[model samples]
Target chain A: MTGAALRLDDVACVRGGRMLFRGVSLSLTSGGGAMLTGANGAGKSSLLRLCAGLLPAFSGSVVRSGGVALCDEKLALDNEAPLHRALSFWAAIDRADAAQVDAAMDAMALTPLAEVPVRMLSTGQRKRAMLARIIASGAAIWLLDEPGNGLDTVSLDLLGQAVGRHLSAGGIVVAASHQPLPIVAPVTIHLPDHQADAA
Target chain B: MRLLWLLIRRDLRLAWASGGMWLPVAFLLLVASLFPFAVGPDAALLARTGGGMLWIAALLASLLPVDRLVAPDVQAGVLDQLAARGIGEEWIVLARLLAHWIGFGPPLMLATVPAATLLKLDAAAMARLELGLLIGTPALAALGLLVATLTAGLRSSGALAGLLALPLAVPLLIFGAGTMSDGSGAAFKFLAAASLLLVAITPFAGGAALRAGRD
Candidate 1:
């Protein structure tokens, strides 16, 4: 995770022929965290996506100095495979060894459900599985969109601890959530109204 | 190289788990099984036209898996995750192309044995048909992938994929069917050329399509 960084320079996003946000900028280095807060449809998720380079910024630039792992609304795991095997698919793709997958599952307390199919997991369990995937990815920068949406209080604590550990290990985290999370982030970007005119 | 192999392996596993591999073969078999009944049991007529019929069946069979090729992964964020791993879109498309070919091409060729028997084809024509499929199916796989990437996000993408691919696949069909009748090796040469061109362009074209449609 050396030299890990996620930087955005005056980023703007336009989706479906409408501008969602503009003039947003943030720079995160190793051991740094940022929380994106905004009302629904205020481009919080879009900003996270921009940082991950999954969506192109309408203007400005996003640059990353390390591998990025994004955990959004989609579980993105194979539905038919067992939970451990589904996570292993991404683990293999990320070039992370099998032990990493096991460790990630352990972090999220998902070891018991290892043999369950992903589709059968409860909503909260599925969210944990998604986080496990990010952990196993071994990526330096994590982009989490609404990671707390379906999580319980205990799971929320797990998520916060995971983020804390990742930052302490020289990784960067950029998360967007409407609800308050337990993780402490030094920087917070609260997106303004979409219709507000800001050049 | 490991990345490519892993991607191919994952694609093959997913295709198998989803039952996508047998669909085209089943469709090919179904078409072949029904062909004799439609035209009546005239062996000479069956032999002469069956080769061409097999060509048509293969072409249509190729379209069966097109909807699943790029769309599911895109929806699942598989491609984006791969992209974030510094895996280029071209490499993803290339791996998918190879996996798709393996899923359909060889099995379809094998299925053609029973299919050819059902169609009343003689030995020589069966050999020509098999050879033609070997060369032409790669192009079909390429075309399906190309169209799948192009139509991934659109509504009714399955129908749109078929519409987009059928036109582009006409050349492979021509060259493939041509091999059945011509005694000379010219049709095989042309078929090989068409396959090479499609296989070569698929990675670039399909990769661009995926990138452009990422939003």
Candidate 2:
């Protein structure tokens, strides 16, 4: 994943007939991380989606040089499958071998819940599962939207450690969070309150 | 192609495990049995009208599983996850179309064996019914997928899917039932044409709908 990068040039986002933000630009190279900060409804999630090409940019362009993984509010796993199988489905799609899945589960401390169905897992556990999915994907760029929402202090520390390891290993991370996380991201993008300005 | 196969396998497993695989077949069989009670057992009348009635039954039965076809996955963000992995929406819909047909189409044809006996259909009529279903069920599955994609995000989408699909399925019904009475093979050709057209456009239409819905 060396030389992996994500760049957004003069980006603009509009949702539901209103402009959420415009003229935002960023450039991140390998082993770098950026934190996105704003109050509620500030389009932080939407920006991450734009970077993933899930949402069309209302203006400008986004370019990336590697496979991307997004860990958002949706778990995107089958509720009926055991946690390991659910994670393995993505692991297979990502072409990540069994060792990667095992390593991801260990990283998230989810080995004990491997046999549990996804629906039975608590919120924090499900969040960890989503993170584990990103880890196992082996993608170079990670777009994490509100990744720490339901995590307790210990889980939060684990999240930070996992992200730190990813950065040290030459992966790129762009995360949106309201609460401060322990990871060191030199760049921060604080979305302006366009809604208030419009009013 | 491996990606498409993985999707089809996952969808088939989901459809089968969720018990949706049997709904349309059971509905078709139930309709076949109920027809005799409703129409009275005039063997001649049953033989004359049974094939068309079965066509109607198959068409209606195709609608039974529409609600689950695309909505659950869209809501679960499964489709988005696939898209993020660089899988095309057309490929996703195509895989789903194949899985949907496998889930309902053949089972419905097999169930038609018992249904044919219940309807007192003679051998000729039975063969015609089976052939029509073989050509027509693919179109029904495609239409269902198209409608499912179109209505996936709507409130009470099942009813809307029914409304949208029934109109599009009229050509299939007309030509499929026509085969039983039209001694000529013309009706079968027309049915095949309609089926191909639906099958050809389904992936594109369903794909565009999914992309638009994300907006």
Candidate 3:
């Protein structure tokens, strides 16, 4: 965390003849924080995808350093794997010793379903498993899409703290959230819909 | 390498524990069983078509659940996490396809024996047929995974999966079953070539899949 910077300059994207975002530019250095807010189908997720490098910007340039953990809309988990194995997805992610996995399960309230296959788990638990991965990733940039979805207040608070810790450590956090998060450090990039007529 | 291995291991573990592995195998067997019941349990007809029947059933069974493969991940916001991992979408796709094959292939092969017995395949024929299965089923799995990826998001993916995948897999099934009946070595060679081609192309296909799944 906190050792890198991300600079996006005049990033414009067009998809299916629709302008996703135009002249979008921003910069975040170590210990920086930002969030994106927009109406339904306003391309918040699209912007996040661009930042994650999953989608190439149609025009303009974006640069970033170090590993970035983007909580994408689709999970990479296969239908076959169990919960623990799915959690250990990145072989490089430092997992708790056996005790730690158990402790994480307790902390996340994931203990009862530790043996359950991920495909069988509910959406909420699945998100928790994914959060566990984010913790293990130790990445400096957290590019999240709806990180608060499927989470109760307790889990949401935990996510906020985890994200707060990342920011405190000089990491950068960028999220496209539906509801305002409970973190004080988050800054909002309010994209105005110029396309809208006076209605 | 670590990321790839963890992905493979996780997928395998899920397959083992969730019984997700068994559904296709059971479906394959069920399809095989349908042959005898429909065809009046004649041993020769049953034995003669066992290889072909098994191959098609395996292919169809392999395709059944794929309609769901990328849908949930897309809905649940896990795919974005995958992209952020910064592993190439290509490798992630490859790792996932490999896991899909492991879960869908062996069980389909194992079901062949039961299929063979149920379909009244003779002793010698069943033994020879298993060899073709062992070699050929992987070809089915590889191609099937690619198809599954291609149609992972379609409105009628259940139907589209076969519509797209069957053409590519037909040759494999043709030669695979042909060899069982005719003892032609060329069929084995063809299957091996297809398997190798699938292995080679899966990474790129997976990359394409990742891009497509993002939508």
- Using DockQ, give the best candidate's number: 2
Which tens-of-lDDT digit does each residue in B60-147 have in candidate 2? 9999899999999988888888898788999999999999999989999999999999999989889999999999999999998999
Top-TM-score candidate index: 2
lDDT for each residue of candidate 3 in B38-145, tens digit (9 for 90 to 100): 878677777777767877777677677676555555555555566666657787677877787777777776778788888777877787677777776666666766
TM-score of each: 0.97, 0.98, 0.82
Name the lDDT value of residue B110 in candidate 1. Answer: 100
Instruction: Tell me the spans in candidate 2 whose CA falls farther than 4 Å from its real position.
Output: A193-199
Provide per-model DockQ scores.
Answer: 0.74, 0.80, 0.50
- Which lDDT tens digits does candidate 3 get at residues A1-199? 5467888898877667787667778899898888888786777888887887877888889898977876755555555666766565542444335554554455566778767877797888778776666555667777877888898898888888777767887888888877887665446776554222311
Candidate 3, residue B179: Cα displacement in angstroms equals 0.5
lDDT of candidate 1 over B1-215, digit per residue (tens): 88889889988998998988999999999999999899999998999899999999999999888888999888887887887677889999999999999998999999999999998898999999999999998999999999999998887888888778888888888889999999989999999999999999999999999999987
Docking class of 2: high
The regions of model 1 sitting more than 4 angstroms off are A193-199
Q: Proportion of native contacts found in each model?
A: 0.73, 0.73, 0.73
What is the lDDT, from 0 to 100, of the residue B90 in candidate 2?
97
lDDT string for model 2 (A118-175, tens) is: 9999999999999999999999999999999899999889999999999999999999
Candidates in descending DockQ order: 2, 1, 3
Candidate 1 global lDDT: 0.91
Candidate achieving higher TM-score, 1 or 3: 1
C-alpha RMSD for every candidate: 1.4, 1.4, 4.1
